[model samples]
Structures are given as structure tokens and as C-alpha cells.
Target: MSNNNLIKGSLQTIILKLLEEKDRMYGYEITQKVKELTAGEIKITEGALYPALHKMEAEGLLTTEIQQVDNRVRKYYSLTKSGKAEMSSKMNELHAFIDNLHRILNPAIDPKLNL
Candidate 1:
């Protein structure tokens, strides 16, 4: 599996977290921010990003604003009230998932038993 595949499941959580940090962001800006934050370890492609954004918008988890920038219209996304609540829930779930994965990957053995 590719790195993109690994990021696929966490994409929603990632996007939610980013938007939580920033009030609003455009598609390209989001892709760039993820690259910068991850130090190029993960790259979010347009194909993957757009569909996710659209789905979230349809689900009322996101609200969009269109603005004119240099004669071009850019759509910026911000979390709705529902989205904020969802973000908190998703963040908690992601944290628990990471903790579980860490435990499974680096399990601790009983000191007395030394198994």
C-alpha cells in the first residue's frame, strides 16, 4: 500500500484539524499546508482532497465562501457549527486509535513474567 492509502482513512480527521487551526482555507492552500506540516512525508492529491471536501459540504460539516482573488474566484472552506462538534469527536477518536495502534505495535511485556 502507498503512503496515500495510509493517509486516506485519516484524511477527514486531518482536514478537520487543519481547519480547526485556521479559520478558513482553500483547496490548494490545504494541500500545501499538509505538505509543509508533514515535511513532505504525505502529499494530498487533488483527486482525494476535492471529493472529501465535497462530501463534507454535502453533509453540512463544512461551509464555503467564494471570493475574488486576482480575477480568479477561489472557494474557501470553513467548519460549520456541526463541523466543530464533529471535529472534536473525530479528534478524540483519532487519538484513541493512535494510542491503540502504538500499543499493538510496541506492546509492553510483564516485567515479572518476562514473556
Candidate 2:
């Protein structure tokens, strides 16, 4: 399976971090940024990303601003104060998860092999 597929649980954290670093970002930009950062390993799909953005906005974790771009009104999302705080906790959780997974998955690495 392609790691480009984001696990739903961690998606919110990644989105929040991106928005936190940048003042605001539009949906496609967000998708592209993640794709680029992951070296194309993780591709965020419109079907998944849009609904997540909407849900985050509805939950007050994010807020949107709109401006006309190329005759189209594009919505940009930014993190709310709560979102900023949440990012720290989420990042910690994600790291813990990855560390735990690593230990579990590679319990018997050959000691001599330099792998």
C-alpha cells in the first residue's frame, strides 16, 4: 500500500501544522504541499482532504477566508488558537505512535547487518 495514503487519525495534525506555519492555505495548495513534502509518498486526495477541511472548520479548529482568484472564489483555511495548541499534542502522539510501531515491526533486526 502506498504510504501516500494518510491514516485518518493523523491527518488533522498534519493539516494543522501546515496551516500554523503558513498564515493560511487553500485546499489544493495544502494537498500539493503534503505531496511535495512526502516526496510523493503521501498523496492527499480531494475526496478525503475537502471533507476533512470542512469538518475541521465546523469544529472551530479552523476558519476560512475567501478571495477571488482567476475569477474563482478560493477558500483559504487557517488554524484557530485551539488548533495551534492542538498541534503540539497531536505531534507528540504521532511520534509516539510511529516509535511504537517501529519497535513492534522490527523486533528482530539482525545485530551484525548494519541495517
Candidate 3:
């Protein structure tokens, strides 16, 4: 599977978790942060990131602020109260999914079998 496909599935969780850690972030900032944190393993393109951000805003999971910096307007995204509440749930879901994937991919060493 392509890295984009894998990242796409967890994009929401990734964005929410990042916002949870930092108070607010702009689009480019989010993209760079992810690259830095993952050591270039993942790259979030504007094509993918903006659509998701707009969707989350429509869903009331995020709010935005426009700021002028370096002679340009930057739209910063921050989690809403509901977004913060949803982060914990999303994180737990992601963790559970990862655990399941790990088990399936490593059945010979499955912890459930004490192997």
C-alpha cells in the first residue's frame, strides 16, 4: 500500500493530535511539523490537508483565525472544545486499530498466544 493511503486513513487523528499538543497551527506549519516529527516518512500535501481542514471546520471540530505575518495572510487552525473532546476518543480508536494491525501482521509472535 502507498504511504499516502496509510496517512490518509489517519489524517484526522494526526491533525487532531498535533493541535492538541500545540495551541494553534497554520497549514504549512502542520505539514512541516509532521515531516519533522516523522523524519520525512510522511508528507501531507496541500491537496489533501486543505480539504480535510475544511471538512473538520464544517463539522465544528476546528476553528480558524486569520493573521498577517510576513506580508501574507495565514489561516491558523485550532481545535474547538468539541474537537478536544473528540481527540481522546479518536486516539483510543487509532491505538486499538494499530494493535489489531500489529497482531495480524505478526501472528507468529502474537502477544495473545504468549509467543
Candidate 4:
């Protein structure tokens, strides 16, 4: 499959972490922030992002505010109480997964027990 499949699986965690740090962000802002943070290594598409945002909003994990910016209206998303709690849980899960993946990819061998 595509590398996006890997990003897709972790999209929720990525968004949650970003919102946690930034407090509030608009859709395009979120995408740009991710690209900036990853130094152009990753890009989040509108197709994947909006659906995830909608789903999180439906689940009560996010709250939105609409404001008129210049001539356009922008919707900003911030984490709700539930979202903060979920963010903590998701962060722990992601960390553990990363640690496990790292171990698998770079196995450590004891010199005394070299196989």
C-alpha cells in the first residue's frame, strides 16, 4: 500500500497532539502545521483531514468556533474536556507503539548471548 496508509492510521493521534499544543487551529492551519513540523516529510490532505475532524466533533471530542476573518469565515477546532482525556490516552498508546517498533527495527543483542 501507500505510505499514507501509515499516516492514516495515526492521523487521530497526530491531530490530537497538534491541537493539544496549539490550543485551537483551523483545517488548513492544521495541515500546514503538520507539514512544517515534519519538515516536509509528511502532508495531510483535506480529504483525510475533514472526515477525521467531523468524526471527532461528532464524538464530542472537539468543539468548534466560527469567525469571520477578513472576507471569509473560518472554523477553528479546539479540544473539549473529553478530547484532552483522550489525548493523554492516545499519546501513551502512540509512544508505546513507537518504542516497540523501534525495538523490532533495531534489535539489541547482548554480547554474552550473541546468536
Candidate 5:
């Protein structure tokens, strides 16, 4: 499993990107999907996940719907219209940040050189 410190900053990006592709997902479903995607390298705790979800909802980046599922209520989340529009830019920004970090860590590679 990856360190929580490393995973912390990118959680929002990860969630947003997943929602961008999956259309809609519930909390546990999101956790499971992320685990499946990363092959168990990353695990999102409920403590971290819900706060982020709620914050995003408050920020208008996500919307939620509560559904009755087998005697339980499941809150499903999906990206809003504004969130969809922001996806590309957010992804690009993330990629650029990673690339810069890569260059900083590996002195032999020039970030300016398009690969």
C-alpha cells in the first residue's frame, strides 16, 4: 500500500478523474474501484473519503443522490456540469506537476524535452 502522506494531496484528483469516467458511484464503490484500479496499492479510508466527498459537494464539483438499496441508503456521487468542464484542466495540471517532480528527482531528464 502507498503511504497516506503521498496519497493525501492527490485524493481529490483521483476521485474526480474516476467520477469523470464512471458517471456515478457510491462511497464504498468508489473505494473498491480505486483499489481495483491500483491493484491494492492504494486504499482510501472512510475518514478521508467522506470529508473529501462532502467538501467537493460543497464546492459544487459534485452532486449526490440518496437511494434505497436493500434496507439501506446509499449516497451516489457524480460530477456536476462545472466539474466536467474542469476535468481536462485539472488532469493537465496534475500531469504537469508530476512531470515537474519527475524532472526534479531525475536530473538526467530534461522536462522541456517532449517525449
Candidate 6:
């Protein structure tokens, strides 16, 4: 599937989970990690990432710190207190979503699934 077809809601979960692990991450790193972790099934573009990040920041779910590296400026994002709290719920929701998708895709293979 093209990257554009990726379920949009998953992006927030990805960002939150990555922050939970990495503590802090810059935009490019987050995109790269998503690509690598998903085996390129997910390709996060700057167009997709930047706006979400900004929105999260605006919503007080994330905080950013700008730094200079090799004469380049980079903004790193980390979870705020609320962001941390939200991460747990987001993780559970993601798990449930994947479970549902798996059921839909391979219902007969799932012993617990009736459909």
C-alpha cells in the first residue's frame, strides 16, 4: 500500500510510543524509526510529521527544544506530563486496534474470533 493509505490515527500512537522509548526525538529520527520499525510499510513524510507534531505541541501533549547540530537547527520533541499519561491509553488502544484488524483479516485463524 502507498504510504498515503496508512491509517492516519496510527501516526499519533507511533509518535507517542517512540517518545516513550527514546525519551526525546527529532522529526527526521521519528520518521526514520517508523519506517524501520514497520519494515517500510510505513513511510512518514515531513508533510505528515511536522503538522502532527505541531498540533501535539500546541495541544500541550509535547514540548520541543531547538538545538544546533553541525550548523543545522533541529527541533526535538518529548512527551509532556499529559503526553506520558496519554501514552498508556494510546498504547492500549493501538493494541486493540491491531487485534481487531487481525480478526477482520484472518478471522478463521483466530481461535477466539467468532467471525
The top-ranked prediction according to TM-score is: 5
Measured with C-alpha atoms, the lDDT of residue 39 in candidate 6 is 96
User: Of the pair 3 and 6, which is ahead by TM-score?
Assistant: 3
Candidate 5 — which residues are off by over 4 angstroms? none
Off by over 4 Å in 4: 109-115
Superposed on all Cα atoms, model 3 deviates from the true structure by an RMSD in Å of 2.2
RMSD of each: 3.8, 4.1, 2.2, 4.0, 1.3, 2.6
lDDT by residue for model 4 over 42-100, one digit each (tens)?
99999999999999999999999999999999999999999999999999999888777
Local distance difference test values of all predictions, in order: 0.91, 0.84, 0.92, 0.91, 0.90, 0.86
- Which pairs, if any, clash in model 4? none
Q: Worst 10-residue stretch by lDDT in candidate 3?
A: 106-115
Predicted model with the maximum lDDT: 3
lDDT of 6 by residue, 1-115 (tens): 6447464767887898899999899998998998898798778889889999999999999999999989999889999999999999999887787788887788577658643
Report the number of backbone clashes for model 4: 0
**True-structure lDDT of candidate 5:** 0.90
User: 61-112, model 5: which lDDT tens digit per residue?
Assistant: 9999999999999899999998887777889988988888888898899767
Q: What lDDT tens digits, residue by residue, belong to model 1 across residues 1-115?
A: 2377779999998899999999999999999999999888889999999999999999999999999999999999999999999999999898877777666776683434322
Tens-place lDDT digits, model 2, residues 1-99: 355444566788889889988999999999999889979878788988999999999989999999999999999899888888788888888887777
- Between candidates 2 and 3, the one scoring higher on lDDT is 3
Clashing pairs in 6: none
In model 2, where is the ten-residue run with the lowest total lDDT? 1-10
Q: How many backbone clashes does candidate 3 have?
A: 0
Query: How far off is residue 94 in model 2, in Å?
Result: 0.5
TM-score of 1: 0.91
